[model samples]
Target: MAILKHIANKSADYGKVLDYMLFQHDDFTKKELLDDKGRKMLREEYYIDGMNCEAMLFDEECEMVNEQYHKNKRYDEIKSHHYILSFDPNDKEDHALTGEKAQALGLEFARNNFPGHQALVCTHTDGHNGSGNVHVHIVINSVRKLDVEKQDFMERECDSRAGFKHHLTNNYLRHLQQSVMDICQRENLYQVNLLSPAADKISEKEYWVNRQGQDKLNELNKQIEADGLTPSKTVFQTQKQSLREAIAEIASTATSLTDFQSGLLENYNISLIHKRGRYSYHLPDCEKNISERALGAHYGKDYLLQQFDKNTKGLEKENTQPEEPQKPISSSFPNEPDVSTIFNPSYDYGKDPIAILFVQTNLQLVVDLQNCVKAQQSEAYAQKVKISNLQQMAKTIAYVQEHEYGSQENLLESFEEVSAKLTDARKTLKETETSLRDINQQIHYTGQYLANKKVYIQMVKSKNKGKFRNEHSSEIALYEAAQKFLKAKNPDRQFPSIKDLKAEKEKLTIKRSAQKDTYNYFRDYQKELRTVCSNVDSILGISRIRQQEQEKSQDIS
Candidate 1:
């Protein structure tokens, strides 16, 4: 699988980004250092290329562009954007992914996505944790230096214009993720669906927090051991992890949302909040609530409800009567009908249509058994085979009737209908999800704009513009980004209020949740239908014959 990660660099010096990629740096402070050989240490194995600028003079070029544009002067202005495309560790062995090939792919990706921006495309053979994944590091100057043709991802006019800072909007990030997936697919390397949300979303920050916490906990445990006492806790749990485990445990057994909420509160001191069809949790001692999006897709309202429904169904099944024991095989076989008559399309049985359908499909199986050379010499074996087929035919009739299918055509048609519904539901869910994401982004930028509006106004009125900007560079950049985003989103310069955006986001989130339920329902229904169809095909020997015919046709071709 190829994983995409984005990091925005705030340092004014662009060389820091390139230096980190090319040289050995202190793990703690990330400062470049010399190797034991008293020389500048380089990465063990890497392939590096520059785009729209010379590799050695990338920082100088970027500085010149910034000077000309009068942008990126603030100390806190984002100087560059770093994107990492990490391939699966197994790809080296499985797909022969090399550093050179990765670097080439990175260059192509940079040229295509971040066109006209000075970029460093480098590929490293190994990662810091010693994972032997061939990963590409794409570092691009935040300020675009040249005018270029507009792309679909370019929303603002400034995006393709010279001296415009690059914007990493939610849509642009999604586009990059899709591009990575496409590249991996085209290269026939290991890939996963990058468009879908992960079941467990652990951000890079959270991962390191957990790791550091664990290390400290281990140290404490060692101290306790040295003092001749057992440590009460052997592991460290981040708040997200605790919330995830609590929710998962309760969702597995809770009968309803109310029950789930109550259980979490009572058992774990966790508060579940469902606001505007979105779920969030507040863990004890945490000042802020964590939304389901942060926890992951699995901890969301839709998935939890689906799990509840599954638990309900499982309980119902458990309460139902047990299946009856199988009947003994009789010694004699009933009068066997002519195989041709049984399978004749025009021949219609007045009742037991399922049984008739089963017999018609299984006719070849019974005939083959009866005509078998080995069976011909064993009377008991022949009798046993006949009895087994009879029992299977009876079960087939019962199974089809229980499912409310009147005939073979009805069963097949039902399966096809459910399959089609599942497909439609999935499409609808995806669209709803996309809309929800857009609304969320809108809400985010709008909030940022509102939060920094006062600071922006102060900066505009300040006597020393450069000094004020440097003092509040972070807020100014955020305000400008949000303002630009709003302008691009609303070309007419009329933007919705933050309240309106939130309302829209809430509405979309509700719709997405409902769509998810519909998708899950249809998906489960389709799975059951598929199982029935597969079992029927297996029992009738239809699948076997189809496979044989396909093989024969392939041979002929």
Candidate 2:
């Protein structure tokens, strides 16, 4: 997924933005790092470029422009706009995304979007919190340097005029996000719909809070382990996460609004507030109530009502008893005995235990086929049909005994079990395949980094550094990207050997093979059970009517 984030800078210093993008910055202080000589330290790994400006002299040119236009004179005036386009970490592994390619895309994006601005387009491979996501930073001077024709995304007259400050509207942000999606699609990279609301809305602040809280919890757990005491809690959940979980749990089973409210209060001590036709939740110890909008669309009133209706229908279906089988009507044809009389002359089919079991189980093979309507028309045909039915009955009985299914319900239960297992097996297989692919990607990148290390080192040491870099730019970018990836994977700076990664890949391949076998086993078992159930239903002439009734009920619902 590629995410676009916008940050408006109010500081008049254009140099600080360029410094932050090009140099190593202190994590907590957000200040550039310096050497003993008091010179800013360039970042170890980054790809820097520019749109409508020199990359190295971005700050100087932007300041000259700002001074010429007298646009960012006041302390409160917006100096620049920073837009970060973060790509999915898997894009590198899955789509062959490199820093050079991302840098080129970033430059293109800046040129197309902020046309008349002195924009610095920088690409970084190392994401915060060791995410290893490749991202691009586009910092455009707030004041346009030149007058230009209006584009479809431009919203105002000043948008195409020089000396006017850049304006960001919600609509413009959406346009930029769409542009990122389009770029990702064109590059065959991993992309997600950035226009839709997230199912779980975690703000940037809340996300960092959760991360910090988890880190603190882990440290606490480490201390407890040092004292030989086991920690009771291993996972940390934010207040919103807890609220979301409570609401989701109750809503899944609640059949009505009252049930939903009461379930939350009784089970989690969370109070529900319905105001202005919207839902909100108040946690037991929280001072303020969190609205449904804060949680996600899934926790909203309309969505919850739909879930409740679905659950109610499911409950009704589960509780409803199966209808009794209807008795066969007698035929009015002359000199022809009806089905009931032909099957049994004196025995009462409605009252007989064996006859009732035959109907309930839908085992047509167990019934006397000689008394069938078609069989009774011919003596020779009746004998042949009886023989066939006897053979089928023996096979059915053997199958039932083999599976230890004493009744129809048992067979149905087995089928359900197999179906569930098959579903789980498929999910596991998919996850395993993903992991295997990740391992292969790791091996590939690790190999690339090792192979191109010498070339990058030579470029750094060469007398004519610019010429060397231009000649071997692709190799250097790949090396840097792979280096950043490996560093993120192993924060201790100990890169794993390619041999070890291949071994891990081999193990994953074996595990995937086993998972595939398990998936196939369940799939085959489910299919066989389904076939048997279908045959029984068809023979009893019950499936078609039952299906029609189900369809009718669905339509009514």
Candidate 3:
């Protein structure tokens, strides 16, 4: 079981495919915090900034909220006002019932373990892998209502952001986690204390072995396949080559019956046999010889006839089947191995997939934010610098117009040069000021993008539900893979070198590029709009003043 939190501006619009992916179910509870109908959850609202709106809640956490409401009467009493808070219980294996239990546990812990003046709970389910590993979401109102605001170490940021008099502490979450563990202990639930050193050691060893073995096996198979063929070789080459070249050179090409047998025996330690009447040959010990599935690679009567037909028709093509395995990789490994002499009984394990996923997603969002902020800041700074230069030019032009002197014959020349310079300098300063204003608008839009990106990653992670790692080493590997697959210019054949593996990082460089570009364009558009609006205002003001003066002159006459 994993616990994750999301603070989204609009909960309904955040995640698109989360409810379906989590296999969440609909329920009509006494207190209906969430309803799962057609891939959407309607949120419960509380008083926030003196307005009634669907409270900002974490995704997939309806049931947990119900359970919490039952345990703590305080939650129900405080949630009378309108504010949005969301919670998601990430479960990926049919564990909604367990999620309910955990939710109950969370409520009891919050009520008895920690004291808060006002609180509310909302829970939803995250469907990962189409399995139900139920998660619980708890949203507590930061306001203490009538209680005295305590300015102490426990005060959290939500207090300031949401405009609450009193602050909330994360100790409430800690206590909830502890309470859930206690319930697990009492109810005999499968408890993997990932934080425990002993458990950590075992997990690391097992995960390493599994990953390394898979990699080595894939590498070996690829090597063998590559070695059997030349770079220029194709399916048609089987017909135009020498018999020996076809059989020995192209591993996929079968020549005489003896050649096939000899190649299999020498390379894979596999032997073939044919019955007295049967045309097809069978590998007697296929399980030991081939890494692929026995049935798929095994030559049957139909395959033999197919190949014969191809030969008779004067067409040549080799078998182009992918490799299979004897058993699933995950099923092949043992849970606990005998390592009494070699390993320690106590070693700390890294965080689980759920925790690691949140951390990575959140961290990536932060990185994107930093990049965005830097770009915006740079553009804004550049605009400021431009404005400064333009202002200097404008001042110089104005000074020249007022102070520079020339003879009556040369006055025309001085006026032409100085007046033109003044007009150009004024225009430059106006454009610079406009650019700066546009940059400011863009910064505001960028902030919105960053906020939305947080919601997007939260939803994406909830859908994945697994494949996250916590170890410094494992985290490095995970991020490197992401970089290769998502960010690399050519990922198919481009693998990061061993030396650079540790240094390589996954980033949303291209992804952020598009977002930043949009923001920047919008910003520029806004700046241009502002300048045009200002020009219009100035023209309107001038026209109004002239009209007023004409009326005054008529009245005076």
Candidate 4:
């Protein structure tokens, strides 16, 4: 049986799809008309082995019935639907059938499903990771030509004339999937239920990341056992491990969405970001965000919510039970706790195991930065809300001052003082914000340096020191520069430890926040000043209106 995936081609480029399935593709360069590593050049042709020139035949049919296509002036429209039918990896029929039978089956399926639509079916015998599987590509035009005297299954179902769409409904798709399963059963070939939920699905980008990571790990493992040291695991591996630990830790305690959000923040220092319509999690100081969907079915927000709704008391009871088998997901990881500190509500981060790791090795710098960012964001939000309240108070004062102020001069003087104070306060806030950003950048460099300090020292002491030095010199140099920057701050050339530096950074961060608070307080005070200016303007408008009414009355009198 085949794994079916539907790709809606809006480019209307059926010819491009034809070129791909027919011609050679270089895996390394992703170039056309070049054979991928495993594909034989003679076998990779439009009419080679068991394949035929059916693409050209289909192109002729499309042109013959293309009358109304010229009227469409839109730059973009649904051009074609490209469906991929991939066979099972273990299926030996791929090696025996020579792709002719697969191509025949694909054509029959497409022709029956999209009767009035022009279709091109091509079979290719290759799979990702060189898995021997015969896959078929079906490209059908979006427009169903009634000039062919045939109505598509969809057109007949909708009771409408065919023109711009060769609709593939859920029932039609399921029918195609079932067709594959039936074909496999008749032929005695390996098959799977296409309608069943996929075991796991990862995006193209993540697939490449894992592919490259595995390649790197394989290369690193070839080094002989000396000093019991292996290459550091890839970032992708680290992220997966972190994600698993974070998920498990949070899931155990979280009974509701509110609990889940707080648990993630306090325990993992992960921020939740909403873009478009979906939710994703961002690590500390990282630009890349991974959706809960991408994490896995288990980690998905909806899934976790369901779990939370299902078992609150039972979940606690389960946690207290004996631990599950540790079959070693990571073969190289040491028997150490994944996280250093428990992120309880009243926990002190400075004394956390993660904080100690920052001192020992700045591996958790991103987490530390995340903590600072959330704190800053919360503080800023609170300050802005207070500013809104002050603005309302200012408007209220304006209404009262309109009657109370004896003259415009007194009000104008008060307004001038408020305006000057507001400007000064804004300047201070801007400066504080800038200071905080600079401090963060500095900390990032320092942390980077500290993280690689051990590797730098080891490389220096080794016999073949220059080998790895070149690999990590730029980051090592950055660390050295950061150290110099820190040393200059101390009059006595005494270099403070990483812990001390982090402590000092925390102090500066606090000072910067205090400056913002000062600015906000001044800004709130100036609200009454703005109200006085408003009162003066209102008093003038009222006086002018009265004069105009009196002149009109004089004419009448």
Candidate 5:
């Protein structure tokens, strides 16, 4: 059966979607090709010949469609619409269709469904990550001004009188699913009932998030295997799964909606946040709040209430039953301290760093200290780079301003310009700092990955391999993926030993330290710059206030 997923692009740049569909042959490297003009191009993919397309060139087709959309000044936030049509990877019947036939089918679906809209449809033999699923990408301009009619005999058995205010109407989506199912039936392909209620519906975003999470967890497990450590779920994974299961179980048994809410806090560390008529569940260890809708209909407010009513009715005589046994440890936060010890009480109102950055807080002081050190290190690197880049002439000019500019008695006129430059400088410095910090972060993760891989490799070579395989399958998968990536970049490259990995990490650390020192110097210079500019601004501000008063007096006289 074909699965359809919709993606709304707010960037309005259909060109990225075009690049994604046609030219992105590989994710890790840019796909370069010589166009008909013999010029090297990165974005353009030569549209395949004998493919059923309204236009021969993919880029030109998208541009033509989107250009017609710009005539309307109605600035909708959603700029482009992407529909992915995926067929079962194992189905030979689906596989038998040529790219041209698949493309033609996708085009017919798009043209009929999105009448009066410009669309680019392309058939692909594999999923983006090489998942081996045959799929078609239909990227359409949102504007609609033309009428479309369903194929005469293939017309939906439902009413045609109703007009749609939005493109994604429920009736239309149902119709589409039925239409696809019909095609599959006629073509004798494996089919799924798209119209049936999903057992547990997961949105596209959540699906990707879960997949990525699994990938990361698997990657970490690989390191554990290498380290010769007993592989298990990370502290984070254990907590998250524990919370989700606890909520589902608690919701299942609770006698009332209020009891369900209270029971969750009493038994588990989970907390519910209700805002704007939507419910979100949170836990101390959780990086982001998850909505009840995301959790599923079973945990939704209406379902909970309905269950509560049924439970209350069923338990008329046992209303005063004893509470179920809970774990000994306290679940919810009792109360926070008078002052946050991690951040200075005077600085930032002693805010919790966990709230600002979604790092594990249960590890407490060690994690907090590490974060502080990392931030300082990143800052120092940026400062050092700026200072090293400064010319001797600029340094001399800065020195002269520091020593003699204030005495000139005309610095106030330059205050605004200086302030503007200072603002721009700080912004640029921050961007540079972030870039350096990201590199350091990547290096840290890489070191961790390498360390774990070494340990895992040791186990894989011994009798312990089977035990490790059963325990850390995810980790092994991730390790294999990493190896493939490494090999792809350089087929001749061999996996480095633990010593080499550590040596590389140490070099990165040394570079970071030097950058930090330079960053510190530049930071000090920035502070000095701010001070000089602020002092002049203060004088100018006071003078302006006095002039405003003088103007009022002149107007009164």
Candidate 6:
């Protein structure tokens, strides 16, 4: 039984997965291998650029052969006939007998059923052992050289349709299985299995391995013996040994088990518990449990306990062992590319989560500034309306004085009344101007804040390389950068520049000790400003209405 499995993904991360599938030695490869990412290397191997198509085979070597076949044939030659066959081994005498039967059956199937199709069969071993389950790769050319020039139209059409080359397809697989089944029945080799009726597919290697049973255990024991250690009689033999060594070392040091456990737990952040029967060392929260079955033989209890003893005498051992000159740090992580510059999308032209959050906050600040500008403009408009009314009143008073000039008494009375009115208007105008100046200054400050905020957002975005979204939020440096922007924009503004704004921002920063707190500060400040403005709208509304009423009265007169 030769088991088959198919897997595929659109991403180019196939190289790492392929290496795992092909080369991993169970625990070693599975544990040591790094995360798989990036584009598949297969495309590069085949030099396929933009060739978005499906591939059938699993092995890379097979892929090379398939590539050659397609390159040589191209589309010029077509397959005229197609045939598939299989053989079983129940009645066959031996491995040689079965192999002969399969080859003969395949050849015969092609000749009888497929008129012009030729057989291209290949055999592969299961790779675990010498169980021979044979399979074939078939390719047939479609184009045929005919002797006669003229032929019946119906027959020519049939030949042309049948001449299309057979590519890999499910139909082809089905055809192969059926062909094998037919041959198996004919040859009386009932043990040959087809994939359908899907008879629990198993690879010949796995089949042989299962049959070989405890021999695999023997191999494991041999590995232990080779490693200069005796085979453990029981599963926890290694753990027990390590425990005994640990206890012996503690006794030598005259140290309590509690002290040792505390030290180990502190360093490793894993639990050390003493049960009634045995002592168990728990794995860290982030780590998966390494099964005793997998590790007990190689990493015996005694070995681990001795390791702890070594750790306890680390300083003494170092004193005895001459200290070599310190080797310079290479600055390169194992298996990592020399990526000096982190792909910080937040800092780059791209938008990361942190950059996005920063931009959004800054944009909000701009919006608040714009609203403040509109508020100032509105107050300015009110001042203009009041001034226009005062000017109109002055004109009327001037006209009255001119008409009463002949009567000294009437003119004097009118002069006094007009003077009072003019004085009041002047006072009102001055106050309005003062208020307008204050509002203008506030608007100016808001504008400055907005500009600084924008720069901060851009700086943060650039720093992150547009990958800010994936970074740890608590570690994000957006806030510090923003604070720098604010300082450069407004040198005089201190820790709490805008009294109300600073208070709100400080609330968010209280818990955060770093730059993260500062960014959060800006977010809270913007939100508070919006709330304050919404509440102040009532006062703004009253001033607007009073100004509008005066204007309407004047318009009516």
Best by lDDT: 1
lDDT of candidates 1 onward, in order: 0.79, 0.79, 0.35, 0.58, 0.54, 0.38
Considering every candidate listed, which one attains the maximal TM-score? Answer: 2
lDDT ranking from best to worst? 1, 2, 4, 5, 6, 3
Worst 10 residues of 4 by lDDT: 357-366
lDDT of 4 by residue, 1-557 (tens): 56787887676444556556666666544556434674534334232211122456555555444546551235476566777878776564322444777777777676656666667777777765456677777777766664344344343543234565666778778877887788777554678877764434455566677667777776675562344754443233446445655675677667887787787787668876656756688888677887766666677666677778776868778889999665342324333222211112242323312111111111110112222323344554344334443443334343333334334454455456656766876776556555554555556656776787787787878888687778878866776787677666555866456576577668767876787676665565455445434433432335456568899999899
lDDT of each residue in 379-411, candidate 3, tens digit only: 543443344433433333222223222222232
Residue-wise lDDT of candidate 1 within 225-283, one digit each (tens)? 99998666676878899788778877878988888989888767889999999999987
User: For model 6, how does the per-residue alpha-carbon lDDT over 441-537 read when each residue is reduced to its tens digit?
Assistant: 4434554555456545554667664565345333334445545555665598663345655454454344333433443545453443343233222
lDDT measured at residue 43 in model 6 versus the true structure, 0 to 100: 15
* Runs of candidate 6 exceeding 4 Å displacement: 1-90, 94-100, 112-115, 121-129, 132-163, 192-221, 227-557
Q: Over 4 Å off in model 1, which ranges? A: 33-40, 227-229, 323-557
Q: Would you give me the overall lDDT of model 6?
A: 0.38
TM-score of each: 0.57, 0.58, 0.21, 0.44, 0.42, 0.22
The residue pairs in collision within model 4 are 1-191, 12-79
For model 2, how does the per-residue alpha-carbon lDDT over 462-502 read when each residue is reduced to its tens digit? Answer: 99999998999999999999998888878999888988898
Q: Higher lDDT: candidate 1 or 3? A: 1
Off by over 4 Å in 5: 11-13, 25-54, 61-77, 93-101, 144-175, 185-201, 234-243, 251-263, 272-280, 285-289, 301-557
Candidate 5 lDDT by residue in tens digits, 180-255? 7877665445678888654355765555666667778878988998999754454233333445566766766678
Query: What lDDT score goes with residue 532 in model 5?
Result: 40
lDDT for 165 in candidate 1 is: 92
Sequence-dependent TM-score of model 3? 0.21
For every candidate, C-alpha RMSD to the true structure in Å: 19.9, 20.2, 35.8, 30.5, 26.1, 38.7
Instruction: Give the TM-score (vs. native) of candidate 6.
Output: 0.22
Q: Report the number of clashing residue pairs per model.
A: 0, 0, 41, 2, 14, 37
Displacement of the residue 146 alpha carbon in candidate 6, Å: 8.8
